[model samples]
Target: MSTALKSIRSIAPLLDRVLVQRIKAETKTAGGIFLPESAVKELNEAKVLAVGPGGFNKDGQRMEPSVKPGDKVLVPQYGGSPIKVGEEEYSLFRDHELLAKINE
Candidate 1:
């Protein structure tokens, strides 16, 4: 397996938690001009790497997660725990904290 994949799999997200990798900003504009790293905007978009088995409800029932691995999703500008493994960066957010899922 790829190092990144292996790194992500090393840690399983706890109940309702989702592992995500932020999608990078475009380095080039629509006009095709190359932009420096500083000129690029940071997007809040991310792709789900892994999801927890679901958290327990007040009645102690298991609540299934809304998202699954490989789903492109929207994340909040704040919150979520940051993690780094083998030189790669990742974030962990709760299922409710995830803003939305990207259809594309």
Candidate 2:
């Protein structure tokens, strides 16, 4: 399938889960100085790009996730599994790992 189709398919069944693509941090300081990778810290905010089917409850019912694609979310700095899609880096985590929905 095409890349666009694949991305769409990945989100179709997302009942409560979400797929996020992290935003790259600024490489330059406010003073226009360049910062190295080691000097930078991981950011907790990200852009939602895909979602999964809702999670299962104790009774087998599906629990819906609150966020959706295109939403900016706050995630744990150290959580989530890293994934590489094509030439880009992405991360996949359960809905629980997302700490909050950032309002913008």
Candidate 3:
């Protein structure tokens, strides 16, 4: 297995879900003033790191997740469960939580 697959396998996102790492908000302005956490808007942009096998549909068939690992996505402001992985914070949510895939 590739190193990327190994790292993703270690995580094993559950129930046809995925884990997303949120992009941290910029703290410094163009003027060089540092902004506090409270001053920053809640960020909905994230990068997909791990994904589960597709969820089962009503017919018991699997439906694949549209977003894949490494895809940048837009999530709802309050969706997903918050988790701390190593020293970084991330959110684990079902594929349904994703609002859109960001285009380059």
Give each model's whole-structure lDDT: 0.90, 0.74, 0.81
lDDT of 1 by residue, 7-100 (tens): 5677789999999999999899999899998998779999999999999999999999999999999999998898877778889999999999
Rank order (by TM-score, best first): 1, 3, 2
lDDT of 1 at 64: 96
For candidate 2, the 10 contiguous residues with the lowest summed lDDT are 1-10
Clashing pairs for model 1 are: none
The residue ranges of model 2 lying beyond 4 angstroms of the native Cα positions read: 1-16
Clashes of 2: 8
Worst 10 residues of 3 by lDDT: 1-10
- lDDT, candidate 2, 62-93, per-residue tens: 88887787999988878676665456667777
Candidate 3 on 2-100: residue-level lDDT in tens?
Answer: 132323336777767888888877898989899988988768899999888889999999889888999999988886877764456777888987999
Q: By lDDT, is 1 or 2 better?
A: 1
**TM-scores across all candidates?**
0.88, 0.77, 0.83
Residue 69, candidate 2: how far off, in angstroms? 0.3
- Top candidate on TM-score is 1
Worst 10 residues of 1 by lDDT: 1-10
Say which prediction, candidate 1 or candidate 2, comes out ahead on TM-score. 1
